[model samples]
Each structure stands twice: as structure tokens, then as C-alpha cells.
Target: MTRPKSTSAHVQPTLAQLRALIAVVDAGGFGEAAAELNVSQSSLSEAVGKLEDLTGRPLLRRSARGTVPTPAGLRAVGHARSAVQAAGDVLLAAQDDSQLSGVLRVSSFRSGATYLLPPVLVAFRQQHPAVTVKLLDGDRAGAGEQLLRSGQADLALIEGVSAVDLSLTPLLMDDYLFIAPESRGTQPVTVQELAESPLLLSPRGDACFQRIETYLGRLGIDTSSATEFEQDSVTLGMVRHGLGITLMPRLALLPVPDGLVLLPLPEPLSRPLAVATLPWRARLPLIQAFTAALVASLGSASGQTTPLALPVWNQSPKLEPEARG
Candidate 1:
């Protein structure tokens, strides 16, 4: 009788080995891939060698120019990339199922973070107590730019301006309100009337100032004579003391001072507020959770009768006042 044919056991490649192969292929050299993987060149080479031995094929060819993947290596690297991404997904899912502990870095302008984020953050903390939310505040343009360029912040809340290569989700449209001393009466202020009033305006280079100028320019109103203040608080204080009338977004009027009167602009104009993130970063569960919390908080704050939809530009929802005794 003929003996049964002998067969060798199949060898499986470890995740580290697959990662080494992929890194080498992408980085185009052993040295760079080793540095990226935070492993010694010898260790990375050994891992790739083991993978090659298991598969019985040469994966990479070293040259004077750089490392190049063999035909088989190219195919293996493709599948290796998918495997590595799958492994990361598994880890992220495990973290989410657990306590979800980690810092969620957020970038936003001072007004957005201070006036808008507090209530949302309070609710977020209650849901994920183990997660810490860190805030980095700056100007709107700078904050959003830094978040994308540096990859330091997971999310950014900023004005709805078109940022190339970044994804923007409009959350709300805040109307510009005419704030005047209570003595001016509660009557709605017309844009034409604003042309004659002594306006306390933000500095010329400010985004708010630019928006206001653009809006007024469309209405044939000239505000070149308006006095410029560097700080919103200073401008608001001047309005409080009856210095001059000022225009501010409704969201910025949080904790509206006792004696100031807020009137809707005769021709209503609103600035869009949006949340931004890199396309890749948006897929993270932690980022998704924070964004969901923000959306829910906005819905609760608005008390709208209709269902809230994203990119809600036309709905001017009323913001509930902070509790006062």
C-alpha cells in the first residue's frame, strides 16, 4: 500500500509582520519604514523576512535608489493594508465598548467655545465621564486651519466659511441682532437706520467686521465712520453704557446684559456656524460621539417643534435663556 502523501502545515503571518511589509512598501525604504513603525531596522527586516519565509516568496527588492515591492509583494501589501485597517477598527471598537477613556482635543474660536460649548460639554461629560474634552481656542480661520494642517485637534467648531480640503457640517444659522441701550426702545432696527447711527464695531480685520461690512454693502449702507473696538466685551460694555449701537450674532449675546435691548434686523441676515473635521478623523467613534452630543444639545437648546436637520441654515431657532433667580 502506498503511504499517505505528507503535507506541510500552513503558516499564518502576524499583524506586526504584515504591518512591516506594508510600511516598507509605502515608505519605499527599510530605514523610513523602521522609523515609522518605531522598530529597529533589523527587527523590521526580520519581521518581513519571516513573512517572506512563510509565503515562500521574496517580497521586496533592495536597490541603489530605494526599496521596491516585487509583483507578489504588491499584491500582499494591498491585502496587508486592509488587514491593518481592520485591526485598528477592532481596537477602536473595543475602546468604545469599554469606558471610552481618552482626551478628545477640540479647536474653536473663543466665542464659539465659551458661549456655545459649555452646555454641550456638560452633557457630553455626563455621558462619557472617563473621556476628557480639551479645548484650544483661537480665531475662527486660524483654529480651523490649525486643526486640519497639524492633525492635533480631532474636531473644530467655526464659522461656515469654505475651507478647501476640509469637511464642514453646518449646525446653526445665528442671526445678527441690533443691540442698543434699553432707552432706544424695543422696536426692530432697520438697516437704513443703522447707517445714521453711531455704530460700535469690531476691528476692521475681524471676521465679524468683514461679514457685517459685506452685509451692509449689499444694502447700500456705509459704516466707514463706525468706531472700532478690539474686544467684544469692550464693545458690548460700550453699548451697555449707551456709547453706541452695535451688531452682534445672537449666539454671542449669551447672558445678555440687563439693560441692553436686542432688536431683529429689519432685513434679517444670519451667519452660518459649522463643525469641521478631516474626512479620516470623522470616522473615529470618539469624534462621532462628541458630534452627536453637540447636535443633541443644540436640539434641546432650540426647543424646536419640527425635527432638526443638519445644515439647518433657514431655521432661526430661539435660544432658551440661562436660568436666573
Candidate 2:
């Protein structure tokens, strides 16, 4: 008599399968997820399909709005993220605890990426040449935190991080300033001037721009006529042309562009820039190493010791003195 074939009762999922599921869910479609993962659409679909087969459940819902996680997928996605993060930690654990090596993925907003991270990255590279650092976009408000929660990034340089789950390391207090064409001169901007100026605004989702709008609105200033620019440099360029004035963080206005002047705001305003990471991952050798490099770079840049805590916000810190004249 022929014995009946038996199938295994257990189901197992590979990191690739879990990652494929996550990408599809996050991107809301196979095509976009495939592009993000740098894989063929068909292959990505296949990976998701296999994951579904193993779990015996359909994991995505396709609709006019786009692909989204099914009920089961919604339940599973969080676990999948945790699993992937664990896999990374395993690699981290395997490394010589004294020496750091592996990919360190970081996300940051435009200003931090441009002015803040470069020196830190340079210092980090010099110390740990074996580690590859990847910078991802965190341009929108809360984008950095979202990337961290989704396990897409190891660290995020963010402004005023409010997420309770992540651990924060305060880096700097970046003051907001009134920026104007040189023709406007070295005078501090008055509230009336700020309220009446044709404002060159950053794009809608920018954190700094949103804060400026909120602060102005509280003072009864109307922002409806502001012209939005996609790039900070472009907005500054327009300001230089005498098209409009803007309120910007000092970091974004660095090097005191030759044609513009930085003026103190009528009222003090600042944002706290910090490095964020999952609480558990905060002490990972790689992250700790990066933190040391970051602190060292900040000290070197400021020509002063990097403070352990961020300074109080809205302290009316002196504007760049050289830009006054």
C-alpha cells in the first residue's frame, strides 16, 4: 500500500518575503514598491504571493485608491517590521563589538542633510570606513519618525521630535530668523513688516514653514498671499531678487548668502534639532559610534564643546553678526 504524502504543518517566512510585503503595503502598490526595492514588478509580486501562500491568507487589497494591507496583513505587518529589525540587530551583534561595520541608514530633512550631517558623516567615515551610511529623505514634518517606526531607517535627524517610542539625542538649537534682500538692510524686522511682506514660503509640508505660519497666525498675520517655493535655495534666490522676504532657520541660510541679510525675528522662535532612534537600537554599537562622531563634528563646527542638552528655544540668540552689514 502506498503511503499518503504528508505536508509540513509549520509555516516559515523569509526576510525577503516579509520585506516585500512591507514595501508593497507602504508604497500602496506593486509598481512603486518594486521601484523602491529595485526589483522587477513581477518578482515583487511573486514574493508577496509566496508570503501569502505560506500564511494561507491574502495580504493586500487592490482598489481605485491603490493597494493597501488586508486585515490579516495589517496584523502581520508590525510583526514583520519587528522581525526585520531583529535580523539587523543580529548582524550588529555578530560584528566585533569593539569595531563597527554594516549599513547605517539615516533619514533627515533638507536643512539638516545639507548643513548638519555632512561634517558628522565625514567624521564617521573617517573613523569607521567599513560602515556604509545611506541617507534617506525626511523632508516632510514627521517623515523621519515615520521612517524609524517602519524600520526603514536606523537613525533620523529631526526637528522637535515628539514621538515617545523613539529615544532622542539633542544636537542643536536652530533659531528662526527674518531673511530679507540686502536692500532691506541690517535692521531687525518688525512685526508690521513681517505681516505685510510678500512672503517667500517653503513648500506646504515643511516643518519650519508650518511653524512660521502658526506663529504668524497667532499674531493675527495673514499668510494667504505667500508664494510657495520647492527649494530653500530658490526661495532665497527670489528674496535676493527683491521678490519677497522669508522666515527661515539659520542653518538653511548658512554661509550668509552674499546678496541677502539675516535679521532677528520680531519675536524669538527656534526649533530643536535632534537625532532619533528606536529606544532599543539607540545603544547599538553602530549608532553609538555615529553619535560620537556627530558630537565631535558639532564641536569642531561650532569651535566650542558640544553641549549635552539643547539650549532653550526662542532665546533671541544673536543673528549671524557678519550678515548684519
Candidate 3:
């Protein structure tokens, strides 16, 4: 009685298999990988050997201490992670239904996803725990476009006063506040006054800062002296440590992170938050569910009778075809 070969040929590598490979290398032995994977040692060895044979490279070496990947194996791990993530994306996509069972792939910045999305996502999970949610991080201008362009994600939450492509819904209305250390004092700092003082900003080329720049220019101040940070969360962190001040949305406020105050922007400096999606995504049920959850969360947080509505991701109504002059 011969044992049957266990690897699937017709399909791309399954997440379980890739993860098992990763486990074998990370754990340093087939036995440990099996234990971690909750399978028998024999099964783990066969699976890993199958993976090794399939890739045509020696992925692991049995050493005195434990297991580790060869040079080729290390590269394999990186590819395996991406394959596993893509597989996970597929699994999430397949689960799409009223239950939001599929994966809800969302791309946003560090602060936007961490602070702005939790309440909505929390509510969404409660409504449909079976649905897998993947929140990716990207910049306001770039991240949203990445989700739509990569076809890996279905929706995006971009915070800014400007518009992107024609396929975006403008969910406007957020007053970008100048947050600073409590030591900066209780009085609200004017944008000009703050800009002159080594302002900490949320990255260059950020749509949020662009809007702020135009608004500040009206007040006769130039922000060329401003300093920017890559991570949205870090920008806030620097302010907390007395680095400088930054502007962010109201939803980005949660427990205030200590030693910081979300001061109201000077009047008339308020900005809009936009939600963009692929035009075809108008029909995605999971996207719709997340949108509903987002509105509900924002309404509850702001204490407003009407929550901001999700924008139409289809071509923007603001854009019109130009005359062929």
C-alpha cells in the first residue's frame, strides 16, 4: 500500500501550504511546524518536501539546533507571504454576501485606518464576524488609488479637500485641527503662528496639507518651513513628545493619546473627507456594508442627526468632457 501524493497541481499554492512552509523555516523543524500547524509530523514533512520539490529549491536544512531556510528559501518565504496574502484576499472575496463573509480589502493611511476605521469595522464585525476584513495602509492620495488600481482591494477612505480621478465620491466635511502638546498652552494657535514654529505635518504631497496650504496662504503665511513625517501616527506622536503641531480629521481622535488637544481649526479652514471606489464596485455588497457601517460610526461619534453619506465611486459628477478645441 503506497501513500498518495498530497499537493494540488491545478490550483495556485493554498495559504495553508505556504504558511506551513513558513512555519517549517520559522520553527526550524518539520515536527515543530507540524505541531504549530496541528498536524502529525509525517504530514508536515511530506507537505514541506512537496513544496520544496515543487519550487525546485531546498527550502530548509535540518541542523543540530533546528531548521532554517537556505538563500533560495529566504526568497521563497517572501514570495510565499505574498502568495498567502493574495490567497487570503481571494478567500475574503469569495465570502462576500449579506453576511459580509468575504474579505473587505480597504486601503488607507496608518492613522485613518487605525483611528478612523475601528468603530465602523468593529460594528461591521459584530454584524458579520464571518466576513474577513483586510485593512491596508497607504497615503491619502496614493493609497486610495492603489486599492482601486491593484484590484486587490474594493474601497478607499481618503481625507482631503481635493478630488482624485473621476471615479470618486466626495464625502466632504472634516475640520483639520492643529493638534499640539498641552505645553503649547490652552489658547488655540493660528495656522500662521503654528507654521512659523516648525510645524510637523503628515508627509509631503499629502492632499490634507495641500488644502491647508491654500487655506493658510489666504492668511498671508507660507508653510515652506514645515517638517513632514511619513507615518500619520508618528506625526501625532511627535506632537505628543513636543515635536510640533499637525492637522488631522476628527475621526482620528481616540482617547487623544495623552498630552495632546485636537484644537478646532481657525474658522473657514474646514476640509472635506472623500471616499473613492471603482465604478464597478457600486454593486459590491461588502463595500456597501462597510460604507453603511462607516456612516453609522461617524454619526454616532459626531453626535449629528445625519451621518455623512458614502460617495459614488463612479466617475465624478464634477468632471465634464471638454470641447475638442
Alpha-carbon RMSD of each model: 11.2, 5.2, 10.8
| TM-score, model 3 to reference | 0.57
Q: Each candidate: what lDDT?
A: 0.75, 0.82, 0.66
Residue-by-residue lDDT tens digits, candidate 3, 216-301: 77877677888887766787788889877777655454435667766666665655565667665544567767776776676666
**Total backbone clashes of model 3?**
6
Residues 1-325, candidate 2, lDDT per residue (tens digit)? 1223225566588899999999998899999999999999999999888788777778888989899988888989988999988988988966775678999999999878898889888777877889999999999989999999888899999888466799998887877888888777776678899888899999877787799999999888988889999988899899999999998987787656777777678888988888899999887889888877777677665555663333222322233433221
RMSD (CA, Å), candidate 3 to true, equals 10.8
Q: Tell me how many residue pairs clash in candidate 2.
A: 0
Worst 10 residues of 2 by lDDT: 316-325
Who wins the TM-score comparison?
2
User: Cα deviation of 115 in candidate 2 (Å)?
Assistant: 1.1
Q: Least lDDT summed over 10 consecutive residues: which range in candidate 1?
A: 307-316
Per residue, candidate 1 scores C-alpha lDDT tens digits across 106-164 of 88876788777899899888888988999876564455656554444668887775677
Ranking by TM-score: 2, 1, 3
Colliding residue pairs in candidate 3:
28-67, 92-103, 95-102, 96-102, 166-316, 173-272
